[model samples]
Target: MEWDWNFVRQIMPVLVQGVKITILATLLGSILAAAVGLVIALGRRSDNRIVARSIGLIAEFIRGTPLLVQLYFIFYVLPDVGILLPPLLAGVIGLGVHYGTYTAEVYRAGIDNVPRGQWEAAKACNLSSRQTWTRIILPQAIPPMIPALANYFIGMFKETPLLSAITVLELMNQAKIVANSYYRYLEPITLVGAFFLAISLIAVVLMRWLEQRYGRIEP
Candidate 1:
């Protein structure tokens, strides 16, 4: 078939709307992931074995399961249990919880890499635990985490398509809808691919800039 400039122009608005949904999901999901992951990471590092072990088990469970299944469970099954959530909310929660496990590990690794002497120095100075973490450990640990966190944000962007499984109508979902309705998969699908690639390239460039900034801060 010949290239269809007219078709491309017609579908551009739909594609733009889909891109908006994708970005919204990614931003919201990343925020949730970051907040939840910090809690999980802290729990895993707790002095209490029960807290640590429980967080560890929960993180493992999340990481062990496929995100699609989690989305289905949240979107489809929860209503039966009286916790009905809207499709978009459920999608965000599912994606957030799924990626939170990964982000928890990233946080844990960063905290662990903080030199032991930092902790010792904090103790020697009689710093309270909160002071030690906020003033010393986190200051050192969080910079190293910037690059990994950026990667997770990018990963979340790609994973927004999984929300389509839950009927959230993100980028891929919109593309599929357009293709099915018009029986023209070529332009829509090609546009979707190009959109993802362009966004991903921009994300990578931003991430590299963040990595350099963080590197300088750490060094």
Candidate 2:
């Protein structure tokens, strides 16, 4: 079908709303993923073998499975067992937890990259575990992690389209709705692609800035 300016104008508002939801999901999911990853990273490093192994296994399981299946389990299966999350909330959880496993490795690598001398010095100074991590190790480790973590968040943003499977009114879903209603795929699909391309470019620019600003580690 020929491109229709009028249909494009008519659908812009709906697509804009979808864009908002998509961004909201990405932002919330990224935050949750960061927090979850840190906890998993720490847990895997725990002195308790049980805790470490359990956490490691869970992380590996998550990383091994498909994200779509996880979303289905969270959104569909949970409701059967007395947990009923709204679609958006469920989508966010799925995205966060799935990506969190991958981010856990990034966190582990970052923490491991800290000099052994730093840990020894912390011990030599008789610093508490909390104090050592907060005051020294994290400060050194987290800077270089920013670039890698930012890359994962960008990946999460692209993966937001998967939310449509769970009934999220994200950009792709909105485009599909418009396309289905009008029986014309070209305009809405093209607009959706254009929208994603524009936002992804912007995100890449921000990621570049973050890499330059926080990806460096000082001697």
Candidate 3:
């Protein structure tokens, strides 16, 4: 059968709207993940062994579970406990928490890469803990961590398709709706792939530029 250009035009607007939702989910989720990850990373480095161990266990639990399962639990199970969230909100929470665990590890690695002497020097200079982190450690750690964080942002974008499982009207969810309505899978599925490819390629280029600008020194 010949490609239906008319059908393509008809679906383009809806699909573009879906793409917007997908991007928004990714953006919001990335912000949550970055914030939560930093908290987890700092907690793991806490002087209190109990706090550090407790945070580590929590991170492991998040990282070990499937994101889809987490999404289901948050979207479906939580409602049973009277914590009803909208579909998209539940999806973003799942994505953020699930991926936050992974981002925590990346942040840990960056902080670890800071020279040991830097911490000692800050201590010797009697810098407050906040000052040590804000003025010294983070400045050194965050730059090298940019590429990894961007990579996870792209990963989160790709994972937005999973949001469809929870009834979020994201790209893949819209494609499924269109396909079911028309019984035509080719166009919508192909469009989903093309959109992901385009966005991923763009992210990779940006990440490369970031890496070049702020990459850590290598031996």
**Model 2: per-residue Cα lDDT over 8-102, one tens digit each:** 89999999999999999999999999999999999999999999999999999999999999999999999999999999999999999999998
What range of 10 consecutive residues in model 1 has the weakest lDDT sum? 210-219
Evaluate all candidate structures by whole-model CA lDDT and list the values in order. 0.89, 0.92, 0.92
Candidate with better TM-score, 1 vs 3: 3
Compute each candidate's TM-score over C-alphas: 0.95, 0.96, 0.96
How do the candidates rank by TM-score, highest first? Answer: 2, 3, 1
Candidate 1, residues 34-64, lDDT tens digits: the string is: 8889899999989999989998998999999
Residue 138 accuracy (lDDT) in model 2: 90
Q: What's the C-alpha lDDT at position 53 in model 1?
A: 97
Number of backbone clashes in candidate 1: 0
lDDT of 3 by residue, 1-219 (tens): 557889999999999999999999999999999999999999999999999999999999989989999999999999899999999899889988888898898899999999999999999999999999999999999988888888888989998999999999999999999999999999998999999999899989998898899884321
Candidate 3: clashing pairs of residues:
none
**How much does each candidate deviate from the true structure in C-alpha RMSD?**
2.2, 2.1, 1.8
Candidate 2 displacement at residue 199 in angstroms: 0.8
